[model samples]
Target: MIYSPPRQANFFMIFSHGNGCDIGTMDTFMKILSDELNTHILIFEYPSYGLCQGSVDINKTTVNNHAERAYSFVHETLHWPTDKILMYGHSIGTGPACHIASTKPIGGLILQSPYTSIQNVITGLIGFPGYLFGNSYWNNLETMKYINCPTLFIHGERDGLIPSEHSKTLYNSLGHIENKQIILLPDDDHNSISYTMSSSCVKSFLKQFFPPSNQLLPEINIDPEFRVPPETIQTSSSIFSYNPFTSLFNLSTVSINATQSVYNSMFSNQYNNQ
Candidate 1:
């Protein structure tokens, strides 16, 4: 899914969604980000999620391959400049976002509700040896060592699933990057970190890279339509509700699967040959 603001965009944000929701579920959120930050957003689905075709496999390698392909499609085919592209990942999506940021050239990176690694998350939550269950998959701590670009980490201080310490650990690991920041939302949780909750912080972070034009002043308030009353905000049980591992703890159901090409034919038909 792609969301382009009415005016020309200075940057492109390649977004990787969490394990639970696919592109279809993130349409509104993507639009909100694009409008608020004044950037074009290209958010893709993992294989077997949403309209993408394939069996469900939520490992680091598979998702990184998908994310790199999306970056190539944006840069090589769609012709977005490498330095003007930013990567944003949420939850499990942060794995691939970190992978691409470490390997590819991009202006910035944003990680939301991120974990240092799947292993660390498992270890922190259940008080067991993480290697016994998660291994080293999606290790953002190791990946952040290679990332030199401006990076922002966002997490809910009240996040019960992954915990806020995950983002703090990742931030501390990126000590070499001068332009790094971490924002912890006091009122948010795993599922409550919506645009309304972090819009100002995100906009402030983006301005350091893409300064607002005269026509687009900074500090503009979020649209009323997008704002949710604090009273209406409710924390969910978990954002990993669709993950298979959660089912082992009786938290949720099995992952979703589907049959289709790993790369959507739309991109091949329209851009691959171009």
Candidate 2:
């Protein structure tokens, strides 16, 4: 996935996924996200996918690949500083998110529909004991000890495959107060969350953490007062229309907006690309 954060972006987010989702799923998400966050979003596909794809040898090893890809995308491609990115994940993606959070000084972490561990999920689904499953994601009781970033966990209360209890257990283990939040929405099942509640929780989480890197990224100026893109608004915008993340830091457009929906459609199309 390639993300261009208006060339002035500093705070970016990157992720990996569960078993079946592809870049296309991630693309739709980024489009919705771009409505609020004007930052870069990257989603990576694991080795185990389409018929010809290679097998994922180790579940835990995924953390390493995610970190490497995110780092490369941030530091090399986006030309942003290392300490400015946030880490986000969904379901199986949490393994890698927790791994990177353990090692990096992330801006924040947003985890949606995460599993406690691979063994826990497998056991829940297959009725097989953890000892019987050779491929264990053993993440349940493990990653919490290492996650150092401000964390937000969102889960579906009625999830059948991976219960919301997994999120509760991790949220309880947090060492601090301001650093954690666990939210479980009502009537939300695993596969259908996006149509119900995931988007709002995502906005809230991003609203909270998006400020940390405001200084590092350029803010777009949409001050109705300034009628034009002041070249001076580099690194921070003089306007406020494009991102609330600007005001979140306690912060856009005309030629880009005179066409309104056309620009939105173009931007939406661009943001959703993997």
Candidate 3:
């Protein structure tokens, strides 16, 4: 489990990641979110992923079981209040998030680069009918109806693999959920949303529940190596107008010097190579 202690924490988060990623891949991302929101975060490794020993089955039952175990550890073992817990799922992680929230009480839920269902994702990719197999693996679109707490959806506008439409449809499907917001990052793809703009969107979404008492803290530095190239700036499935560059510099807590230093390092390496 990964955790970040806050000066004055209002909530704790249980974070689940996507397929092929373990806690190691999410270390920095989780830390960034924890620092920005000033909350303790618990990142659980799926069965067979990372050091957790279990079958590598990515089915509904196993994933839900993992979510249950993690929640129990935080709620039963750690004794955190039920209402003070938040669930965050990214990509395939949305499966367990929806599974747990469908039956449990949580302060809120955050799904990043989510899918309607794993079956839907497969159909969208291969053009094959998912119903042919009669599987309902990770049916978040259906499970969402049972969630009454605040919900936040973050997706990449240029996400081709799962498409932003999946998240849009999921949002629309949550008919009576008044406290829900969908944010689509224009310049990012499925894999880049967290580093690009997840923090800003999360901070805004969390404000209604956990109002900021302290000034925005300095941001954790993102790896400079993953900068988006200019050539890939294509339009995505965004219904809202967005400018990524402005968002990057206008962050509530990110330092101008740090941003500049990242750019300087990138440019210096390029110049030296030339």
TM-score of every model versus the real structure: 0.77, 0.69, 0.74
lDDT of each: 0.73, 0.60, 0.71
Over 68-185, each residue of candidate 2 has an lDDT whose tens digit, in order, gives 7766756566565555667777776677777777766667777888877766764555344545445434474577787667788888899876789988988888866466788897
Q: What would the per-residue lDDT of candidate 3 be over residues 1-274, giving only the tens digit for each residue? A: 5455446566779988776557766777777887887787877766555556443544567668878998997777767778778999988788899888889988889998899876686556544455654564568888878988889999989987779999999999888888899988898887776563787888889986655444433332224332211121222211111212222112232354455566568778999999
Q: Sort all candidates by lDDT, best to worst.
A: 1, 3, 2
Residue 107, model 1, lDDT: 85
Considering lDDT, which of the candidate structures 2 and 3 is the better prediction for this target? Answer: 3
Displacement of residue 246 (Cα, Å) in model 2 is: 45
* 268 Cα displacement, candidate 3 (Å): 57
Q: Comparing candidate 1 with candidate 3, which one achieves the higher lDDT?
A: 1
* Clash count per candidate: 1, 15, 0
Candidate 1: C-alpha lDDT: 0.73
**Scored by Cα lDDT, where does model 2 land?**
0.60
Q: What is the lDDT of residue 92 in candidate 1?
A: 82
Sliding window of 10 residues with minimal summed lDDT for model 2: 243-252
